[model samples]
Target: MPTPIIIDCDPGHDDAIAILLALAHPGELDIRGITTVGGNQILDKITDNALKILSFVNADIPVAKGAAAPLLGKLVTGEEAHGESGMDGPALPASKFKPVEQGAVEFMLEIIRASEEKITLVPTAPLTNIALLITAYPEVKERIEKISLMGGGLAYGNVTRTAEFNIYVDPEAARIVFESGIPIVMSGLDVTDKAAIFEEEIQELKTRGPVSVMVGELLDFYSIYGKKMGFVGNALHDPCAIAWLLHPELFESEHLYVTVETEGKLTRGMTVADRRKKPDQPANTEVLLGVDREAFIKLLFDSLERLDRQLGSPAGES
Candidate 1:
């Protein structure tokens, strides 16, 4: 049976690709729904972006709008990296699907309570919604199989000198989730930076088909931002989280006691991973530190090709 999962995201370019990758493999992952949170953009735009991406792939999954702001701070968006519209590359057609009236937290509780099997959560954006879900309904934690999230960094930070964007957007929420005692896989920048797709692979993806072309365009736009940050190509940050769930063999991780620094002025969102276990805190997260880049890129391309074949359109037109 496919592992049932829910994707909580902000629909940044990579988040869109992550959703596509998850949908492409129905046999491996059964996506219960997609929940949008405030990151990369505000709640309204990110939710709309999520709907449009799902529509592009002809998925009929449920979508729900989640928390509009963080638990304590004002919302911060990544328009500089993702563009003002959040997903700025491809001219996405208006979404045919509409989000359910139930809010993201409520929907998560409902699904977790109703499902017979444990559900895995892939969060590729700010963790406000997941934190809210846990805080509002603590019992749901037991039903969650694991949380594979894209945020934090052990080496360097993208937002601050020590914080990544998603976690930096809402450190308090991140702290709550990190301390929630649930199983977690942290696909931080340490590994994602290694999963970069350069110009050659981007061009190759464009030639695969319509869906691939769309992915290629998204990556192209994303790569420009990467270049500005001194990277040779775009790092598949959000997709790494989903990719790990699908192909754990392509990655390596270490168990560490990780905590979010919610009070530091300079490192508020920093993930303080106790690799040496000096704090004597019980290990709580599997912090990914390495990836087989060749295998990962191949799997990503193959998944996009499969989806293109299934959809049979460059823009998903039947």
Candidate 2:
């Protein structure tokens, strides 16, 4: 049987691809629901982007609006990167799908409690919703299989000198989740920065299908910053979480004692990974340090090919 999972996202350019990648592997992942939080954009924008993207792909997954702000601070979005629309490049149809009436926490509680199996959470956004879930309903902690999240890093940071964007957006919430005792798989910048999908790949991807074209266009806009930084390609950051869930063998990881720095003067939102010679605390996060970039990209391409098969020909292929 496929493993049950929930995707909590912010619809960053990479977040949309992550959802498509997960959707393609219906046999491996029984996606129970998707919850949207404020990160790449505001809750309203990201949530609508989620609905529109799923509608484009004809997926039936339930979506719920999540935290509009962090647990303790004002919301800050990655709008400078993702643009005003959040998903700027894709000219998607207006969403025919409406999110479930309940908020994200309640929707998550309902899905988790009703699932016969423990649900793994794929959080490609800030930790706000997850923290609220566990804090409000402590009993649900035992029902979670694990949290496979795209944030933090052992030695790299995207948003601050020592902080990654997702965790940096909501350090208080991240702190709560990191300390919650649930097993975690951290697909942080250490691996994700290496998970770049380059120029030629994006160009070729556009010809594959409707989904591929959408993804390719999103990547086109997304690659500007990476290219400016002189990276070989754009980092497909959020997709690393789903990739880890599907193909753990493609990545090398270290079991480290990790904590979120909520109150550091210069390192707030930094994930303090204890890589000491002999640490007292037990390992809390499976910190992804390296990845087989070739195999990981192949996995993404193959998944998109599978999705292409499910739909009709791409536009202009008639």
Predicted candidate 1 versus true structure: per-residue lDDT over 1-318, tens digit per residue: 999999999988999999999998999999999999999988899899999988888899999999989888689899988998998988889999999999999998989999999999999999999999999889889999999999999888998999999999999999999999999999999999999898998988777777898899998888888888788877999989999989999999999999999887888899998767565588999999999999999889889878888776442333
Q: Deviation in angstroms for 62 in model 2?
A: 0.5
Pairs that collide in candidate 2 are: none
Residue 91 lDDT in candidate 2: 85
Q: Estimate the lDDT of model 2.
A: 0.92
Per-model TM values vs. the true structure? 0.97, 0.97
Per-residue C-alpha lDDT of model 2 across residues 238-298, encoded as one tens digit per residue:
9999999899999999998899998888899999987775656889999998999999999
lDDT at residue 303 of model 1 (Cα atoms): 90
Candidate 1 Cα misplacement greater than 4 A, ranges: 277-280, 313-318
How does model 1 fare in lDDT? 0.91
Model 2 residue 95 distance off true place after TM-score fit, in angstroms: 0.8
Quote model 2's TM-score. Answer: 0.97
